[model samples]
Target: MWSGAAHVVDAMEKWPSSQEPTQTAYGLAHGTDLTFFEHLAGNETKAKHFSDSMTFMQSAPELRHDFVHEYDWSRHARGTVVDVGGSKGAIALKLAENYPNMKIIVQDRAEIITHGPRYANTNIEFQAHDLFTPQPVKGADVYFLRWILHDWPAR
Candidate 1:
Protein backbone atom coordinates (compact mmCIF):
# COMPACT_ATOMS: atom_id res chain seq x y z
CA MET A 1 0.00 0.00 0.00
CA TRP A 2 2.93 2.36 0.63
CA SER A 3 3.95 2.00 -3.00
CA GLY A 4 0.78 3.95 -3.93
CA ALA A 5 1.61 6.93 -1.73
CA ALA A 6 2.24 9.19 -4.73
CA HIS A 7 -1.08 8.22 -6.28
CA VAL A 8 -2.91 9.06 -3.06
CA VAL A 9 -1.10 12.41 -2.89
CA ASP A 10 -2.19 13.17 -6.45
CA ALA A 11 -5.76 12.33 -5.59
CA MET A 12 -5.58 14.72 -2.65
CA GLU A 13 -4.80 17.47 -5.15
CA LYS A 14 -8.45 17.28 -6.26
CA TRP A 15 -9.54 18.24 -2.77
CA PRO A 16 -7.45 20.23 -0.29
CA SER A 17 -10.16 21.07 2.25
CA SER A 18 -10.21 20.28 5.93
CA GLN A 19 -13.45 18.37 5.51
CA GLU A 20 -13.35 14.58 5.89
CA PRO A 21 -14.36 13.02 2.60
CA THR A 22 -16.04 9.64 2.23
CA GLN A 23 -13.11 8.33 0.22
CA THR A 24 -10.13 6.88 2.13
CA ALA A 25 -6.44 7.02 1.26
CA TYR A 26 -6.36 3.30 0.56
CA GLY A 27 -9.40 3.56 -1.66
CA LEU A 28 -7.88 6.41 -3.62
CA ALA A 29 -4.48 4.77 -3.73
CA HIS A 30 -5.85 1.50 -5.08
CA GLY A 31 -8.66 3.08 -7.13
CA THR A 32 -11.18 0.58 -5.82
CA ASP A 33 -14.74 0.80 -4.50
CA LEU A 34 -14.21 -1.55 -1.57
CA THR A 35 -12.20 -0.64 1.53
CA PHE A 36 -9.17 -2.56 2.81
CA PHE A 37 -11.17 -4.83 5.13
CA GLU A 38 -13.77 -5.48 2.48
CA HIS A 39 -11.08 -6.44 -0.01
CA LEU A 40 -9.47 -8.77 2.52
CA ALA A 41 -12.76 -10.42 3.47
CA GLY A 42 -13.39 -11.28 -0.18
CA ASN A 43 -9.98 -12.87 -0.56
CA GLU A 44 -9.07 -15.87 1.63
CA THR A 45 -5.30 -15.45 1.28
CA LYS A 46 -5.33 -11.74 2.04
CA ALA A 47 -7.71 -12.20 4.96
CA LYS A 48 -5.41 -14.85 6.41
CA HIS A 49 -2.51 -12.44 6.08
CA PHE A 50 -4.46 -9.72 7.88
CA SER A 51 -5.23 -12.06 10.81
CA ASP A 52 -1.70 -13.49 10.83
CA SER A 53 -0.29 -9.99 10.87
CA MET A 54 -2.36 -9.10 13.89
CA THR A 55 -1.09 -12.20 15.69
CA PHE A 56 2.54 -11.63 14.65
CA MET A 57 2.41 -8.01 15.71
CA GLN A 58 1.69 -9.13 19.27
CA SER A 59 5.16 -10.72 19.39
CA ALA A 60 6.55 -7.19 19.67
CA PRO A 61 6.62 -6.28 23.35
CA GLU A 62 6.39 -2.56 22.56
CA LEU A 63 3.03 -3.13 20.91
CA ARG A 64 1.14 -4.26 24.02
CA HIS A 65 3.66 -3.88 26.82
CA ASP A 66 1.69 -1.17 28.57
CA PHE A 67 -1.63 -2.97 28.33
CA VAL A 68 -0.23 -6.20 29.74
CA HIS A 69 1.93 -4.69 32.48
CA GLU A 70 -0.08 -1.58 33.37
CA TYR A 71 -3.57 -2.99 33.36
CA ASP A 72 -4.47 -5.43 36.16
CA TRP A 73 -6.25 -8.05 34.07
CA SER A 74 -6.26 -10.29 37.16
CA ARG A 75 -9.14 -8.16 38.39
CA HIS A 76 -11.24 -9.73 35.66
CA ALA A 77 -9.80 -13.17 35.94
CA ARG A 78 -13.17 -14.81 36.51
CA GLY A 79 -15.11 -12.39 34.30
CA THR A 80 -15.96 -12.36 30.63
CA VAL A 81 -14.25 -10.25 27.95
CA VAL A 82 -15.82 -9.48 24.63
CA ASP A 83 -13.29 -8.44 22.02
CA VAL A 84 -15.38 -6.35 19.68
CA GLY A 85 -14.20 -6.37 16.07
CA GLY A 86 -11.41 -8.73 17.06
CA SER A 87 -9.68 -10.15 14.00
CA LYS A 88 -9.36 -13.93 14.42
CA GLY A 89 -8.95 -13.76 18.21
CA ALA A 90 -5.25 -12.89 18.22
CA ILE A 91 -5.51 -10.63 21.26
CA ALA A 92 -8.25 -12.75 22.77
CA LEU A 93 -6.00 -15.79 22.58
CA LYS A 94 -3.26 -13.94 24.42
CA LEU A 95 -5.64 -12.84 27.16
CA ALA A 96 -7.00 -16.35 27.54
CA GLU A 97 -3.50 -17.77 27.83
CA ASN A 98 -2.71 -15.45 30.72
CA TYR A 99 -6.04 -15.83 32.52
CA PRO A 100 -7.30 -19.32 31.95
CA ASN A 101 -10.27 -18.63 34.17
CA MET A 102 -11.47 -15.72 32.07
CA LYS A 103 -13.71 -16.27 29.09
CA ILE A 104 -12.61 -14.28 26.05
CA ILE A 105 -15.10 -13.97 23.20
CA VAL A 106 -13.75 -12.78 19.86
CA GLN A 107 -16.24 -11.12 17.52
CA ASP A 108 -15.64 -10.12 13.90
CA ARG A 109 -16.96 -10.63 10.37
CA ALA A 110 -18.06 -14.16 9.46
CA GLU A 111 -15.38 -14.38 6.80
CA ILE A 112 -12.71 -13.59 9.34
CA ILE A 113 -14.18 -15.70 12.12
CA THR A 114 -14.05 -18.78 9.90
CA HIS A 115 -10.28 -18.57 9.85
CA GLY A 116 -10.09 -18.60 13.64
CA PRO A 117 -9.75 -21.87 15.58
CA ARG A 118 -12.88 -23.76 16.52
CA TYR A 119 -12.09 -23.05 20.19
CA ALA A 120 -14.92 -25.30 21.28
CA ASN A 121 -15.55 -25.77 25.00
CA THR A 122 -12.69 -23.52 25.95
CA ASN A 123 -12.14 -20.12 27.50
CA ILE A 124 -11.74 -18.72 24.01
CA GLU A 125 -14.95 -18.34 21.97
CA PHE A 126 -15.81 -16.97 18.50
CA GLN A 127 -18.75 -15.02 17.20
CA ALA A 128 -19.61 -13.42 13.86
CA HIS A 129 -20.79 -9.86 14.37
CA ASP A 130 -20.88 -6.55 12.55
CA LEU A 131 -19.30 -3.86 14.66
CA PHE A 132 -21.62 -1.20 13.19
CA THR A 133 -24.72 -2.96 14.52
CA PRO A 134 -25.87 -3.39 18.08
CA GLN A 135 -23.60 -5.68 20.08
CA PRO A 136 -25.35 -8.91 20.97
CA VAL A 137 -23.21 -9.66 23.98
CA LYS A 138 -24.22 -7.66 27.05
CA GLY A 139 -23.09 -7.38 30.68
CA ALA A 140 -19.52 -8.26 29.84
CA ASP A 141 -16.80 -7.54 32.38
CA VAL A 142 -14.72 -5.79 29.73
CA TYR A 143 -15.22 -4.87 26.07
CA PHE A 144 -11.89 -4.62 24.30
CA LEU A 145 -11.70 -2.46 21.21
CA ARG A 146 -8.16 -1.97 19.98
CA TRP A 147 -7.32 -0.21 16.72
CA ILE A 148 -11.00 0.37 15.95
CA LEU A 149 -11.06 4.18 15.77
CA HIS A 150 -9.20 4.42 12.44
CA ASP A 151 -11.86 2.25 10.80
CA TRP A 152 -14.98 3.71 12.46
CA PRO A 153 -13.92 7.13 13.60
CA ALA A 154 -17.41 8.61 13.24
CA ARG A 155 -19.76 5.71 13.72
Candidate 2:
Protein backbone atom coordinates (compact mmCIF):
# COMPACT_ATOMS: atom_id res chain seq x y z
CA MET A 1 0.00 0.00 0.00
CA TRP A 2 1.16 3.52 -0.82
CA SER A 3 -0.81 5.06 2.03
CA GLY A 4 2.22 6.67 3.64
CA ALA A 5 3.50 7.71 0.25
CA ALA A 6 0.08 9.17 -0.43
CA HIS A 7 0.55 11.57 2.44
CA VAL A 8 3.72 12.75 0.77
CA VAL A 9 1.97 13.14 -2.54
CA ASP A 10 -0.91 14.99 -0.92
CA ALA A 11 1.49 17.35 0.82
CA MET A 12 3.18 18.27 -2.44
CA GLU A 13 -0.11 18.69 -4.27
CA LYS A 14 -1.72 20.83 -1.57
CA TRP A 15 1.31 22.95 -0.75
CA PRO A 16 0.39 25.84 -3.04
CA SER A 17 -3.24 26.23 -1.88
CA SER A 18 -2.62 25.76 1.88
CA GLN A 19 -4.20 28.54 3.97
CA GLU A 20 -1.50 28.84 6.58
CA PRO A 21 1.62 27.31 5.15
CA THR A 22 3.27 27.63 8.52
CA GLN A 23 1.17 24.64 9.58
CA THR A 24 3.04 22.68 6.91
CA ALA A 25 1.79 20.91 3.80
CA TYR A 26 1.21 17.66 5.65
CA GLY A 27 -0.74 19.46 8.37
CA LEU A 28 -2.82 21.22 5.73
CA ALA A 29 -3.51 18.03 3.82
CA HIS A 30 -4.68 16.30 6.97
CA GLY A 31 -6.49 19.41 8.22
CA THR A 32 -5.87 18.63 11.85
CA ASP A 33 -5.17 20.97 14.74
CA LEU A 34 -3.20 18.38 16.64
CA THR A 35 0.54 18.45 16.43
CA PHE A 36 2.15 15.56 14.56
CA PHE A 37 2.72 13.49 17.71
CA GLU A 38 -0.66 14.31 19.24
CA HIS A 39 -2.52 12.78 16.28
CA LEU A 40 -0.78 9.46 16.97
CA ALA A 41 -2.63 9.08 20.26
CA GLY A 42 -5.71 7.77 18.47
CA ASN A 43 -3.83 5.41 16.13
CA GLU A 44 -1.69 2.80 17.81
CA THR A 45 -0.42 1.08 14.67
CA LYS A 46 0.59 4.33 13.01
CA ALA A 47 2.13 5.53 16.24
CA LYS A 48 4.21 2.39 16.58
CA HIS A 49 5.31 2.55 12.97
CA PHE A 50 6.32 6.19 13.36
CA SER A 51 8.15 5.70 16.65
CA ASP A 52 9.82 2.51 15.43
CA SER A 53 10.92 4.25 12.24
CA MET A 54 12.48 7.02 14.29
CA THR A 55 14.24 4.49 16.51
CA PHE A 56 15.59 2.61 13.51
CA MET A 57 16.92 5.73 11.78
CA GLN A 58 18.48 7.08 14.95
CA SER A 59 20.04 3.80 16.01
CA ALA A 60 22.64 3.84 13.25
CA PRO A 61 26.02 3.20 14.85
CA GLU A 62 27.77 5.96 12.92
CA LEU A 63 25.16 8.56 13.92
CA ARG A 64 25.24 7.49 17.57
CA HIS A 65 29.02 7.35 17.58
CA ASP A 66 29.27 10.82 16.09
CA PHE A 67 26.82 12.26 18.63
CA VAL A 68 28.51 10.51 21.54
CA HIS A 69 32.03 11.48 20.54
CA GLU A 70 31.51 14.88 18.93
CA TYR A 71 30.17 16.33 22.11
CA ASP A 72 31.44 15.90 25.64
CA TRP A 73 28.38 14.55 27.43
CA SER A 74 30.69 13.86 30.37
CA ARG A 75 30.61 17.52 31.36
CA HIS A 76 27.13 16.96 32.76
CA ALA A 77 28.16 13.87 34.68
CA ARG A 78 25.88 12.88 37.54
CA GLY A 79 23.40 15.50 36.37
CA THR A 80 19.95 15.03 34.90
CA VAL A 81 19.42 15.11 31.13
CA VAL A 82 15.93 15.13 29.65
CA ASP A 83 15.71 13.45 26.26
CA VAL A 84 12.63 15.07 24.77
CA GLY A 85 10.75 13.06 22.13
CA GLY A 86 13.26 10.31 22.70
CA SER A 87 11.31 7.37 21.41
CA LYS A 88 12.44 4.01 22.89
CA GLY A 89 15.48 5.58 24.60
CA ALA A 90 17.93 4.35 21.98
CA ILE A 91 20.30 7.29 22.36
CA ALA A 92 19.69 7.54 26.07
CA LEU A 93 20.82 3.94 26.50
CA LYS A 94 23.97 4.66 24.52
CA LEU A 95 24.60 7.79 26.54
CA ALA A 96 24.01 5.79 29.72
CA GLU A 97 26.60 3.26 28.66
CA ASN A 98 29.30 5.92 28.32
CA TYR A 99 28.13 8.24 31.05
CA PRO A 100 26.56 5.97 33.61
CA ASN A 101 26.54 8.60 36.29
CA MET A 102 24.28 11.02 34.41
CA LYS A 103 20.61 10.52 35.09
CA ILE A 104 18.70 10.40 31.77
CA ILE A 105 14.94 10.70 31.41
CA VAL A 106 13.79 9.70 27.93
CA GLN A 107 10.48 11.38 27.23
CA ASP A 108 8.03 10.82 24.37
CA ARG A 109 4.30 10.59 23.71
CA ALA A 110 2.28 8.26 25.95
CA GLU A 111 1.87 5.93 22.99
CA ILE A 112 5.64 5.72 22.67
CA ILE A 113 6.29 5.38 26.38
CA THR A 114 3.93 2.39 26.53
CA HIS A 115 6.36 0.51 24.30
CA GLY A 116 9.61 2.06 25.53
CA PRO A 117 12.77 0.06 25.55
CA ARG A 118 14.04 -2.06 28.45
CA TYR A 119 17.56 -1.77 29.75
CA ALA A 120 19.62 -2.68 32.79
CA ASN A 121 21.13 0.79 33.08
CA THR A 122 19.83 2.32 36.28
CA ASN A 123 20.58 5.86 35.19
CA ILE A 124 18.28 5.76 32.18
CA GLU A 125 14.48 6.03 32.44
CA PHE A 126 11.50 6.28 30.05
CA GLN A 127 8.70 8.82 30.55
CA ALA A 128 5.49 9.77 28.76
CA HIS A 129 5.42 13.46 27.91
CA ASP A 130 3.82 15.71 25.32
CA LEU A 131 6.33 18.34 24.30
CA PHE A 132 3.59 20.71 23.08
CA THR A 133 2.47 21.04 26.68
CA PRO A 134 4.48 22.73 29.38
CA GLN A 135 7.56 20.79 30.36
CA PRO A 136 7.00 18.98 33.63
CA VAL A 137 10.62 18.19 34.43
CA LYS A 138 12.27 21.47 35.26
CA GLY A 139 15.87 22.55 35.66
CA ALA A 140 17.41 19.56 33.93
CA ASP A 141 21.15 19.82 33.36
CA VAL A 142 20.63 19.20 29.66
CA TYR A 143 17.57 18.98 27.40
CA PHE A 144 18.38 16.65 24.54
CA LEU A 145 16.13 17.20 21.51
CA ARG A 146 17.17 14.55 19.10
CA TRP A 147 15.37 14.17 15.74
CA ILE A 148 12.32 16.05 17.01
CA LEU A 149 12.54 19.77 16.38
CA HIS A 150 12.79 19.69 12.61
CA ASP A 151 9.16 18.68 12.28
CA TRP A 152 7.87 22.06 13.41
CA PRO A 153 7.98 25.56 12.06
CA ALA A 154 10.71 27.93 13.23
CA ARG A 155 8.16 30.21 14.79
- Which structure among the candidates has the greatest TM-score? 1
User: Where does model 1 exceed 4 Å of error?
Assistant: 3-6, 15-22, 119-121
lDDT (tens digit, per residue) of candidate 1 on 1-155: 45347666665775564234345566677676576788677889978877887777778877754565578999999999999888877777678878999988899988889887775556998999988799899999999899876665453
Candidate 2, 1-155: lDDT as tens digits: 13435466566565654444344434554567565566677779878888787778776766544688878888888899999988888788778888889999998888899976778737988888889899999999999997777676555
Global lDDT for candidate 1?
Answer: 0.77
Clashes of each: 0, 0
Span of 10 residues, lowest total lDDT, candidate 2: 17-26
**Candidate 2 residue runs with Cα over 4 Å from true position:** 1-4, 7-10, 17-35, 61-65
Q: Name the Cα RMSD for model 1.
A: 2.4
| Candidate 1 residue pairs in backbone clash | none
